[model samples]
Target: MPARLFAVVFGVLLTPSFLLGQVGGDRLIARISRDDANGDGKLTEAEFTGPRRLFETLDGDGDGVLVIEEAAARLAKVRSNVAKAIENRSEEMGNQSQREAIRRRLQETRGGARARVEPDHENIRYGDHERHVFDVYLAETEADEPAPCMIWIHGGGFRRGDKSEGGLFARSFTENGIHYVTLNYRLSQHAIAPACFEDCARALQTIRYNADKWNIDKTRIAIGGGSAGAGLSQWIAFTPDRADPLADDPVLRESTRVSGIILLNAQTSYDYRWIQEHVPGEAWKGDGLQQLFGYDVDRLDEISDAKFELIEECSPLNHLTADDPPMMLFYRRSSDPEIAEKNAMDGIHHPIFGTELKKKADQLGVGCEVFSVENENDMRVYNQRWTMAVDFLKRQFESVQ
Candidate 1:
């Protein structure tokens, strides 16, 4: 209780692997900072358990430098461990028929699977994790013109979701002469925050790396997703360019920038304060943030500086800059009370996220549109919003010239 409470008060659990595994950094600082749950940027006795031995093993020399082979080996182990965890989760579910049904529902809606249509590329692997794959749906698009792409990330609060959930997007975009790609990133059930972002970034990079062969316009790519996926898209589009010119890997060398972004039922900020301030009446009791952060609220009086800073760093609101691409946000303006009653965090999809995001975009002179739906208009409202977003994306793509 005390350990998890430490997280609730401080905000966010430590995740140093993003630094250690991706771009080598101060080994001691990276390892200790992650284990340092209180976020003092230094490890305490209780927090000293993480990354200590792993660093030692990786740093074979008495010198503190991490070697190339060692880093690669470490990353491989991490990927292997994450993949095994997912497999274990599947076995634990113990319901083969239910799982099959979910897979069917993924590629098919009420209208049944889109048969007789085959994707240009299927199960393209972008990373080591099993979920780090994507499907590409290519239109009979113009030969003279490279098709603009829409990469959709699926949303399930970083816990339960798959890229196939966005399978419907393939036909919608492809029919309009745009190539569409739906991707699966690492989920918290197997991995967590940085894993999700890293997977998404790598997938985009992989697409760009193969843009020419795939007939995709590298300059006109648009990103989008729902809920957690939406947050990932915003983080990539708004966050400063992550292109590491110094990295040796070609994929890592590719740019993470996009021409436009679309967000649905988005989370504009991971900050608890932002959630509390913008949410509708009496929605403060939700602990969804804690789950997303993979923490348990301790209701402690004090906070951790490092943890708070990390949370802010991860929040898309904090990443917004003048250079961000145009964005279209879709959300619900109100909640169904009955539905709201079922989930403690029903207001997560509220328009407040879009409302606040619009305010920030206005401040930065970035193009941002917010669409709020108060009632069920059936697929009519969705089609309208989709049309607007696709038009916006097409305009953005054309302007890329």
Candidate 2:
């Protein structure tokens, strides 16, 4: 009787793995190797100990047993394991199904999984002091007409993020007959204000210089990004003719005239005081922003208010004008009480759209549209926002026509 209980429990625990192994032992082994609790590269003694107990229960009627009750219990445990394996496989199938759907749709309209636009990389020096290179995504979108173009910047605060981050966005735009470009710039930690902006401008010039080969539509060009990239995108959108003409390159003569803007959870402006008042915590403190201006926020007074002047220069809000491109801002609301329950720190730092930023866009008559995402994970919201961006661009192009 004592060994019978152990066998029953052992059978219950062992049956699941044995069952799963029959169906997809290789897959089960792979997942176990990756996420196993003990990390012994294989299931450890502690892991198998419970299964051993279940196996013992399968030896009932205790005359060194092999009875009907023990066999029935083992069979039931095997069934349970089989059910669990099916459930896990079903989940994997679902993800594969989604990817196939997206791929099929893309093939129906555009070409295969390959990016529609051919990408090119080149190294170039911008200004006398700052030297950086950029990558260009291009295609002969039209035979006779000039295709609309977009310069896509990536976001990872000002410290991180790269140009070739999202192939999906590039493919989406290109498939819809829009040409686009993406480039890398000097990061914030290494250089101060205007260096990123300057590098971006130079990259634009390089593209324009070779525009003939790329078949760029110079008259209809736009810039866009998310987060810090959105901030930079917004800055370039509104600040027309900000590029220096005195620079050696003719590309600098070209204007950054985007007809519309798309921003996602972007820091619209860098007011440490504003961020501090609303955002709470030292995460958005001035020290980080101060680094952009080569000064410490604490030392701002001694530096003759240079911090404030730098703030003005770097703030996207300061660059906004009545003629700025139409703006679409997507943010979130804090309606979920369970946010903290799900995660302690994430619940605290969840981004909320500021009212004043929306008001500023409205005041400028910038064709601003603001929306809030609720009750869903951010990845879902990101998909929705990408659709909105596509729609927004379509409408903007249509209105111009």
Q: How many clashes in each structure?
A: 0, 20
**lDDT tens readout by residue for model 1, 285-312:** 4444665555545652354776567667
User: Against the hidden reference, what TM-scores do the models get?
Assistant: 0.67, 0.63
lDDT of 2 at 255: 64
Which candidate leads in TM-score? 1
Candidate 2 CA-lDDT value: 0.55
Error of 2 at 281 (Å): 3.6
| Tens digit of per-residue lDDT, candidate 2, span 3-74 | 443343323334333432233334433443443453422232233333433323332211111223225544
Deviation of model 2 at 65, angstroms: 57
Candidate 2 local Cα displacement, residue 128, angstroms = 7.5
Query: Candidate 1 regions off by >4 Å?
Result: 1-118, 281-288, 299-303, 335-343, 375-380
The alpha-carbon deviation from the true structure for residue 100 of candidate 1, after best TM-score superposition, in angstroms, is 25
On a 0 to 100 scale, what is the lDDT of residue 86 in model 2? 36
